[model samples]
Target chain A: MEHTWDFAAILANWRVLWVGLQGTLIVFAATVTLGLGGGLLVGVCRYAKTPLLRLPSMAFVEVFRNTPVLVQIIWFYYAFPILTGIEVNPFLAAVLGISLNTMAFSAEIYRAGIQSIEPGQWEAGRALGMAYQQTLRRIILPVAIKRILPALTNRGIEVFKMSTLASVVAYVETLNQAKLIADLNFNPIESYTAVALIFFAVLYPAVQGTYILERMLRKSE
Target chain B: MEWNFWAVMTDFDLLLLGLVNTLKVTALALLFGVPLGLCLAVLRLSGARLVSAAAAFIIEFFRTTPPLVQLFWFFFALPILIDVRMTPFIASIVTFSIQSSAFFAEIFRGGIQSIDQGQWEGGKAIGMTYAQSMRRIVLPQAVKRMIPAFMERSIELLKTTTLVSTVAYTDLMFQANDLAQKTFRPLEVYTVVALMYFALIFALSQLSIAVEHRLAKSGDSTVR
Candidate 1:
C-alpha cells in the first residue's frame, strides 16, 4: 500500500469549507453580542455590590467560567431540549452554550474595567447631584470602555477561536467539515492542516491588531 | 428525559475515569509546559534578533489558534506524517503541551519582564552569568509574583483537558456525553458532571485567592 498527501480531495469540498467558515463566523458574532451585553449587566450588578443581584450573577459567572464549554454545549444540546421540550439544532445550542460560557469571563473583564475608574469620580458625580446611574453612564462607562476596549477585543478573538469547540456537537463548523472531508479522502494532514491555517488566518490579525490598539491607547494616555 | 440521580450514580465510574484522565493530562501538561514555556520566554528574550523573532512567532501563532483544532490535527494527522501510531492520550498531551506552552510562554515573559533593570545590572556588577543571575535573583522573585497567574493558567489548562474527550480519550466531558447517550438521561448526567467541574475549579480559584492573600501578608511584592 502506498500513501500520499491529498489536498485536492479537500479542495473539491471548497463550498462546504466556505459554509463552515460562515457558520463559525455567525456563531462568533452571536456569542460576542449576547455575551458582552449579558456580561455588562452582570458586571454592573456585581460591581455595585447589590446583594440579591450580585450573588446570583456572581454564582452564574463562577459556574460558567469554571466548566468546559464542551460539556456546556452537550448539556444544552440534550438537556435543554428535555427540560424545555424545545429542540434546538446544533448551531443554536452551541451558540447559547458558548455565549453563556463566555459571558462569565466577559463579566469578570467588565468588572475589572468598571473598578478601574477611581471612586473619586463617583463622589464627584454625586457632588454634582447626579444619580449613580448617571455617574456610570457619563463617567465610569467612558473611562472603562477606553481602558477595556482592547481587553474586550482580545476576548472577542478568543470567542472566535472557541467556536471550534462547536465541532464536538456535530456542528458543521470548519474543523468538523474538514474532518468529514479528510476522513472521506484519507487526507488528514492536508485537510486538518488547512483547517488550522484557516483558523490562524482568521484569528491572527485580530489578536495582533488588538495589541497595536492597546499600545496606541496606552501611548495616548 | 427523566432525571434519575441513581442512574447517574451508577455510571459514576465512567465519569470518575474521565475525571482522573482530565487531572492526569492537566498535571502532566503543567509539569512539562511550564518549563518549556520558560525556555521559550528566555529564547524570546535572547540577544539575537532572529532567535527572539522565531520564539515570538511560535508563541503568537499557537496563542491565537484553537487548541481543539490543534488537537484534531495532531491526533489525526501527526501519525500519518511521522509514521508513528500514538494513543489518543499521547496525542492530547502533545497538542496541549504545545498549546499551553505557548500560553505559559507569554505568562513567563510577562513575569520575567516585570523584574527591574537595576536587578539585571546588579547581577552584572557581581559578574554573574544571565543563567546564574536568573537562578539566584530574578526567577525566585518572578516565580513568587507569578503564583497567582500560574494558578489561573492551571485552571485554564484543567478546563481545556475536557477537550481530550473529543479525541475519544474518555475524559469527563466525553464520559458524561457517553453516559447521556447511552442512558437517555442527559439532563441528570450532565448536571452532575457540570457540578463536579464547578466544585473543582471553584476550589482552585479559592486556593489562588488564599495564595494571593498569603503573598500580601508576607509583603513579598517582587519589584521591591
Candidate 2:
C-alpha cells in the first residue's frame, strides 16, 4: 500500500495534543507526590521492628513490584469500585495505580539508601544526644536522601514513563489521546509518532537532568 | 461481599491457562533473548569501533524507550513501515526479545569487563586463541559473575510480560481483565493474580540468593 505522510493532520490537532500533554503531566505530578510519600512510609515501615507493620509492608512491596502496572491499573479501576461501592474516575484511578506501583519501587530504593549509611552515623547521632526521631528526621533522612537522590531521580523517570500505561484504562493521557485520534483518522503512525515524540520530549530531559543533578551532588560532596 | 468458593474455583481453570501462556511467553522470550544478549555483549566488547558503536546504539535505543511503546511500535507501527503482518504473540516475542537483549547485553558486558586483564593475558600466554580463551575460561567465569544479574533480569522480564496484553495478547493480566469484567470482582481476581506473580518472583529471588551463596562458597579460595 502506498500512502502520503500528512504532517498537516497532526499539526492541525496540536491543541488536542497539548491537552493530552496536560493530562500526562497531571498524572506524572500526582503519582510522584503520592508515590514519594507512600514509598517513604513503606520504606520506613520495612525497617520497623514491629512484625505487624513490617510483614504487611513487605507483602505490599512484593506484590506491587512483581505484577505489571497494567494489571494494577485495571484492578484498581474495576475492583476498587466493586469493593468500596465508590466509582473512581479514570484519571484518579490512573494516579492511584501509578502511585502504588511507584511506591513499591521507591520503597526498595529507599531501603537500599538507608542501609548504605554507615553504622557510625547512628553512633555519632546518639553521641550528639539526639533522640531517635530527631536523628532520623534531622540527620539520617538528610544523609540518606542525599545518597539516594540519584536512584530516586531514576525512579521518578520510571514513574513518568510508566504513566503511559494509564492510557489503557481510558485515561486521556497523551498516549490514549493519540490512540483516539488514530482511531478516528485511521492514521496510527502519525498519531502514535506524535505521542512518542511528546513523551520523549518530556522524559528525555528528566533523565538527562537527573544525571546532571547527580554529578552536581557528587561535586558538592 | 459474600465468599464464592465455587465461582472462584471454576475461574481457576482459566487462570491456570493464563498462567501457562504467561510462562510460555516468558520462557520463549528468555530462550531467544539471552543468547541474543550475549552476542550483542560480545560484539559490543569487540575491539572494533564500528561493531561496538552499532551494538551500543541498539542497546541504548531499546533501554531508554518504554517497553509499551516498543510493543506498540512493533505490533502496529512496524507493519506499516514494512509491508508485512505479524501476529500479536509473534510481535510480543520479537519485541520483548529485542528489549531484553539490550538489558542482557549490558549485564553481560559488565560481568565480562569486571574480569581482570591479567586473566585474559593468562589465557593468551597459554597459547589459546581469543575465541578459545573467551569460550573456555573467560565466559565461564563471566557467567558466574552474571548469575545474580541474570536472575534479576529474568524477574524483570517476567513482570514486563504483563505489558503483552496491551497488544491484545491473552496472558495472565488479560485473563484477569476478562474475569474481572465478567465477575465484577476486580479486586479479588487481581489480588489473586498479583499474589501469583509475587510467589513466582519471590521464589526466583530465593533461588538467586541460593545460587550466589553456593558460588561464593566454591570460589572463596580463588579470590585474589
Candidate 3:
C-alpha cells in the first residue's frame, strides 16, 4: 500500500501552529531566564563553604536532576494544588517543571565552571581587599560564564525542545497544536512530520553553531 | 489538605507493575539502541559521502526533535503511513531505541575519535583489515573508554522512557495518573511515583559516578 503525502492540511493550519509557536516562545523565554538565572545563585550556594547553604542546594539539585521532568510537571499540575491550595495552570506547571529541572542541571554546570577557575584568581581578589561575594561576582563568574557559554547555550536549546512537553498537560505548544491539527484534519503524518521538520529547522543551525562555538573555545583555550 | 497513605497503598501493586513495565521499556531500548548507535557511528564515519551524510541526518534529526514528538509520530502517524497496527509498547520501544541510538552514535564517535591515529596505523602496519582492526583493537579499547558516557546516556534514556506514559502505556507515570483518578489522591500517588523514579534514577546515577571515579583512578582516559 502506498500512502500519499499531503501538506495542504498543514499549510491551511498555519495560524494554529503560529499560535503554538507563540506559546512555545513564551514558555521557553520564561523558563530559560528563570532556570539559568536561578541556577547561578544555586550553583554558588552549592560551592559555598557553609554547610547550611551547601547541603540544601545539593539536595535540591539531586532531587530535581534525578527525577524525570514529565513526572515533575504532572506532580505540579495535579499534586501541588492539593498540597498547597494553589491552582497551577498547565503553563505554570510546565514552566515550573522545566525551569526547576534546568536549574538543577545547570547548577552543576555552573559549579563545575566555577571550580575550574584557579585559586590564584581568588587570592588576587582578596589581595585587593575584595570580600568573598565581591571577588566571586567580579573575578570568578565573568571568566566562568564565558568558559561555559557553549554549555549554557546547549541548555537553552534543551529548554526549547522541552517546551513541547507542556503539551502533555494540554498546554498549547507546537506538539499540542500538531496533535490538534492531526485530530481535526485526520492528517497525522503530515501534521507530525511538519512539527518535526519545524523543530529541526530551528535547532539544526543552533546545534551546528554549538559545534563551531566549542571548537572556537577549544582554540582560544 | 490532609494526607492519606492508606488509599494509595490499596493500589500499590498496580504502581509496582507499572514500575516493572517502565524498567522493561528502558532495558529493551538500551538493548537495541547501543548496537544501532554503533552502526550509525560506523556509517557516519564511512568514507562514502552519501552514506555518512545520511547517517548524520538521522542523528541530527532525532537529537534535535523532542522525544515526545517522536513518540507521537511513531504511535499515531507511523501506522497511517506504513499501514500497520501499532501498539503503544512497540511505538515506545521503537522511538526510544532510535532516538537514543542517535545520541549513542555521538558517544561512539567521540570514543572512537579520541583514540590516536597511530592506533589505526599500527593496526594497518600489522597487515590487519579495517574490520579486523576495528573489531579486535579499536572497539575493545573504545568500548572501555565509552563506559562512563554510555552509562550516563543510559540514565538519561531511563528518565526519557517516562514519555511512554503519554501514549497510555502502563508505565509508572501512567499508572500514577490512573491511580490518582481512581483514588482521588493525586498528591499521594504522584509524590510516591516521583519518589519511585527518583530512587531508581538516583541509584543508577550514583553507580555511574562510582564507575567513572574508578575508571579515572585506574588511569584510563574516559571520553564524554
Candidate 4:
C-alpha cells in the first residue's frame, strides 16, 4: 500500500480537538477527585465493625469492581432516569460511572494499606486517648496513605484512560472529537493517531514517575 | 415507569449470543496475548541494550494508551494504511491481543525477576543454556507465581471486550444496544445485560480469589 500520510487535516482541526481536550481534562479532574475522596470513606466503612456500614460498603465495592465501567456508564445514562424519574446528561452519567468504579477499586487499595499497618500503631493511638476517627485521621491514614501511594496513582492513571469511555455515550471527549475529525476529513489515520499520541504523551511520564516512587518507597521502608 | 423484565427475557437469546461473542473474543485474545507477552518479557530482559529498549518502548506505549483508541486505530485507520479489509472481530482481536500482551509482559517480568538468582546459577551449573534454563527451570517456577496476576489480567481483558461493541461487533453490550432500540426498553435491556455481565465477572473473580488462597496455602508466593 503506497498511501501517502497527511496529518495536515488533523492540524487544521486543532480547535475542535482542543475543546475535546478540555472536556477530557474536566472529566478526569472531576472523577479522580471524587473517586479517590469517596474511596477513602468507603474504605473506612469497609473496615468498620458494624454490619450496617461494612456490608453495604463491601457490596458496593464488589459490584462496582466486578462490572465493566462501560456497562455502568450506559446503565446510568439509560436506566437511572427511568428508575428514579431523574434525567441524566452525558457528563453526569460519565462522572457517576467512572468515579464510582474508581471508588470501588481504590477502596480495596486503601483497605489493603490500612491492613498492612502494625496493630501497635492503632494501640498507641488508643493509648493516647484517640478515638477511632481520630486515630484513623491523624496516625493510621497518614501512614497508610503513604504506603499505598503507588497503587492509588495507578488507579488514577486508569481513571484518566477510562474517561474516554464517556465518548461512547456521545460525551464530547478527546476520542469523540477525534472521531468527528476523522469523519470530517476522511483522515482516521491522523485523527486517531493523534488521540493515541496525546494519551501516551500525557500518561507515559506519570507511569515512569510511579516506578520511581515505588523504588523510593521501598528503599525508605 | 414500570419495570418489565419480560420484555428483555423475550430477547434473551440475542444477549446470550452477544455474551458468547464476548467470551470468544476474550479467549482468542488470551490465546495470542500470553505467548506474545512472554516474548516481550524475554526481549525486554535481553542481553542487548537496543533490543531490550525497543521491547520496553512497545510495552510502555501500549500500556499507556487507552484500549479504545487502539481499537479505533486498527478498525478505522490501519485498513487504510495497510490496504486490508478490517472486520470488527479482526480489529478487536488484534487490538486486544497486543494491548493485553503489554500488561501480561509486565506480570511475566515481575514473576521471572522474583525468582532467586540461585535458580539461574543452578541451571548454569547443570550446563543448561539460558534458553534451556528459562524454559525448563525458571519459567516453571515463574508461571506458578504468575497465576493470580494472569487471572486478574484476563478478567480485565474480558471486561475490555465491551469496547468491541463500539465498532458494531455484536458483543453483549452491542446486543443490549440493539435490543433496547428494538424494544424501546433501554431501562430493562441495559439492566438485564448489566446483571448478566455482573454474574459472569463476579463468578470469575470469586474463582480467582479461591485459587489465590489455595496458592497461598501451598506456600507459593504469587505475584500481583
Candidate 5:
C-alpha cells in the first residue's frame, strides 16, 4: 500500500495560519515588553541587600522558574478571572501568564548581570557622590546591559518559543492553528512539517545572532 | 471569600494518581535521555564530519521548536507515518526523551569541552585510545562536572512533564484540570497543583545546590 502526502489541506488553511501567526507575534511582543519591564524591577530588587526587597523577589523568581509554563498559563487563565471579579479573554490571560514567567527568568539573568559588575565600579560611583539610584541608572545599568545582552537574548528566544503554550489555553497561535488544520484535514505531516519549518525560519536567525553578538562582545573584551 | 479546599479536592485520588504519573514519566524520561544524550555528545565529537553534522542538525531542529509542537507531531503524525498507533502516554514519553536528549547532549558537549585540554593530552600520553580515554579518564570527571547541570535538566524535564496533561495523559495537571472542571473551582484546583509543583521543585533545587557544593568541595580536596 502506498500513501501519498498531500499538502492541499494545509495550503487551504493559510489564512487561518496567518491570523494565528499574528496572534503569536502579538503575544510575543506583549510578553517581551511586560516581562522585561517587570523583570527590571524584580532584578533591581534582587540587587538590593535588604530582605524587604530581596526575599519577595527571590520567592517570585523561584516560583515562576520552577513551574511549567503550561501550568502557569493554564492556572493564570482560569484563576485570574476567579480571583479577580474581572474577566479576561484567553489572549490577555496568556500574555499576563507568559510575561510573569518570562519576568522571573529575565530577573535571574539581570541579577547575574548586576552581580558580574566589579564591586569597585560601585565604589567608584559612590566616590563620585552619585545618588544610589542615579548610580544604578547611570553606571550599573549600562554595564549590566552590555554584559547581559547575549544571555538575555537567549532567554528572550525561550520566551518566544514558550509563547506557543498560549495555544493550549485555547488561544489560536501558530501551533493551535496548525493543530486545527491537521485535525480538520487529517494530515498532520504536511501541516506540522510546515509549522516546524516556519518556526525554524523565525528562530534560527535569532539563535545565530545571539552567537554572533556574544562572539563580538567577547572579542571586544 | 470562601475558599473550599475540600470541595476542590473531592477527587483527591485522581489527583494523586496524576501526581504519580507525572513522576513516573519524569523518571522514565531522565533514565532514557541522559545515557542517549551522552552517546550523542560523543558522536558529535567523534571527528566524523557527517555524523557530527547530522547530530548537530537534529539537535538544533529539536531545540529550536517548542516541545509542545513536537509532542503533537509525535502524537498525531507519527501514527500516520508509521501506521501504528501510540497511546498519548507513549507518545509523551517518546517526545520528552527525544527532546531531553537534545538538551542533554548539548550540556554534555559543553561540559566535555570545558575540561582542560591537558586532560585529553594526558590520556593520549598514557597510550589510551580515544574511546578508552573518554570512558576511563575524561567521562567520569565530565559526569561529575555535569551533575548539577544534569539535575537542573532533570528538574526542567519534570516541569515539562506537565505538558503530557495537554494530551490527556493523566499527569497531575490533567487531574487538576479535570478536578477544576468537575468542581467549578479552577482557581482552587490549580492553586493546589501549582503549590505541589513549587514545593517539589524547590526541594529538588536545594538538593542540587547542596550536591553542587559537595562536588566543588571534593574537587578542592583533590587539589590538597
Candidate 6:
C-alpha cells in the first residue's frame, strides 16, 4: 500500500514547529548556562583536595557519567518530586536533569584540563611569591581553559544532541513537538524528518564554529 | 510506606529477566557492530575515493546524530517509508549495529593508520599479496592497538541499549521506568539501575586497562 506524502499539513503546522524551535532554544540555553556553572564549581571542588568536597564530587561524576541520560531524566521527573516534596515543571526538570548530567562530565573535563598543566607552572608562580589563588586565577586557569575548550566544546555538542531526549518527559522541545504533531496528524515520517533537519541545521553550524575556533586557537599557540 | 525488603527481593525475578534481555541486546549489538565496523573501516581506507567518501558520510551521519532519533527512525519512520514492518528486537539490533559501526570504523581507521609505513612496504617486499599481508601481518598488530578503543565503544554501546527503552523495548531501563511509575519510587528504582550499569562499565574499563598495560609491555620489547 502506498501512502501519499502530505506537504500541506506540515506547512499548516509550521507555527507549531516554530514554537517547538523556541522551546528547543530555551532548553539548550538554560542547560548550557546552568550546566557550565555547576560543572565549574564541581570541577573546582574536585580539584581542591578537601576530603569533604572531593569525595562527594568524585562520586557524583562517576555515577552520572556512567549511567544513561534517559534513565536520569526519568529519575528526575518521577523520583525527584517524591524525594523533595516539590513539583518541578517539565522544562525545569529537563534543564536540571541535562545540566546536572553534563556537569558531571564537564567536571572531569575541567579536572583533566587543570591537571594537564605542567607542574612547573605552579612552582614558578609560587617562586614568584604569587598566592595560590592568584596563581591559579591569573596563570593556570587561563592556560587550562584555552587548552580544554575543544574538549569542552565537544561535550557541549553532546549535551545539545542529548537535549532531544527531553521530549520523553513532555518538555515540548523540537522532538517532543514533532512527536505530538505526528501523533495528531498520523505522519511520523514528515514530522520527525523536519525535526531532524532542524536539529542538523542548528548543530552543524555549531560544530563548524567549534572547529574553526579550535584552529584559530591552535594557530595562536 | 515502609521499605519492603522481602517484596523487593521477591521481585528479583523481574530484575533478572530485565537483566537477561539487556545482556542479550548488548551481546547482539557487539556481535553485529564490530565486524560491520571493521568492514566499513576498511572501505573508508580503500584507495577508491568515492567508496571512502561514501563510507565517511555514513559514519559522520550516524556519529553526529542522536542514537535515540536513529532508533526512533528505525522503529517508526523506516516502516512507513518502506512499507515493511520490523519487530522491535530486529529494529533495535539493526539500528544499534549501524550506529556502532560508525564508531568502530573510526577506531579501526586510527588503529590502521598507527601502523608504520615500513610494515606495508615490508609486506610488499616479501612478495605477499596485500590482502594476505593485512590478514597475517597488519591486522594482528592493529587488533592489539584497537582493543582499548573497542572496549570503550562496547561500554558506550552497552549504555546506549537504554535507548531501546524509547522504542518500548523491555530492557533494564524500561523495567526501571515501569517500576518507578508503579511504585512511585523513582529514586530507588533508577538508582538501582544506574548502579548496575556503573558496575558493569567499571569492570569493563578495568579489564581494558589491564589489556592496555600488557599491550604496552609487548610494544616495548618489539621497539627494543
How well does candidate 6 match the true structure in TM-score terms? 0.91
Please give, for residues A5-107, the per-residue lDDT of candidate 1 as tens digits: 7678777899988988988988888999999888898889887656888898888998898888877888898888888999889998899989998889889
TM-score of each: 0.96, 0.90, 0.99, 0.99, 0.96, 0.91
Model with the higher lDDT, candidate 3 or 5: 3
Error in Å for residue A65 of model 6 = 1.4
Q: Per-residue alpha-carbon lDDT of model 6 for B68-87, expressed as tens digits?
A: 77887788778988877777
iRMSD of all candidate structures:
2.2, 2.0, 0.8, 0.7, 1.3, 2.0
Model 6 spans with C-alpha error above 4 angstroms: A1-5, A213-221, B1-6, B213-224
Give the runs in model 5 whose Cα sits over 4 Å from its true position: B220-224
Tens digits of per-residue lDDT for model 6, A82-178: 6787888788778877898889989988898889899999999999999978888889989999989998898888887888888888888778878
Best model number under lDDT: 4
Q: Give the per-prediction TM-score of chain B.
A: 0.95, 0.93, 0.98, 0.98, 0.94, 0.92
Best by DockQ: 4
Comparing to the true complex, what docking class would candidate 2 get? medium
- What's the ranking of the predictions by lDDT, best on top? 4, 3, 1, 5, 2, 6
> What's the DockQ for every one of the candidates?
0.69, 0.50, 0.88, 0.90, 0.71, 0.52
Model 4, range A97-174, lDDT digits (tens) per residue? 999999999999999999999999999999999999999999999999999999999999999999999999999999
Better of 5 and 6 by TM-score: 5
Q: lDDT by residue for model 2 over A97-190, one digit each (tens)?
A: 8899899999998888787888888788899999877877787889899989999988888787788888888888777777777777777778
Report the lDDT tens digits of candidate 4 across residue range B137-199: 999999999999999999999999999999999999999999999999999999889889999
- By DockQ rank, best first, the candidates go 4, 3, 5, 1, 6, 2
Shift of residue A141 alpha carbon in model 2, Å: 2.3
